[model samples]
Target: MAVKDAAKDEDDDNEVSAEPTPPLPTPATPPPSPTQEHIPSSPQAQTAQP
Candidate 1:
């Protein structure tokens, strides 16, 4: 019974060690730059209304 228990523990350890970790998800596209030149100015900038 002790031998069987030891074998079972070894098997469990092997299973835990052999698992393939899932790869981290990748972004579909690169993030936009914070200081990009093409960003439009706010509406407040174009109007004089207070």
Candidate 2:
């Protein structure tokens, strides 16, 4: 019925909101930190050798 469809749609919206949103920003934010750290570390080693 109409009520059942509305409930299902609400649940699907909640699940979609909960699942993808947290993980999208999580991987995105972490990758930049590691890459920046690695880049700085490489330059630090070169600086030390010189």
- Give the distance in Å from residue 11's predicted Cα in candidate 2 to where it truly belongs: 0.4
Where in model 2 is the C-alpha error above 4 Å?
24-50
Cα lDDT tens digits for candidate 1, 1-50: 99999999999988776663222122322333432422444454556454
Error of 1 at 28 (Å): 23
* Per-residue lDDT of 15 in model 1: 78
Candidate 1 off by > 4 Å: 20-50
For residue 24, what is the lDDT in candidate 1? Answer: 19
Q: Evaluate model 2: give its TM-score.
A: 0.41
Give per-model CA RMSD: 9.6, 6.1
Give the best candidate by TM-score.
2
Worst 10 residues of 2 by lDDT: 26-35
State, as a TM-score between 0 and 1, how close model 1 is to the true structure. 0.38
Tens-digit per-residue lDDT, 1-50, candidate 2: 99999999999999999999999999899899889999999999999999
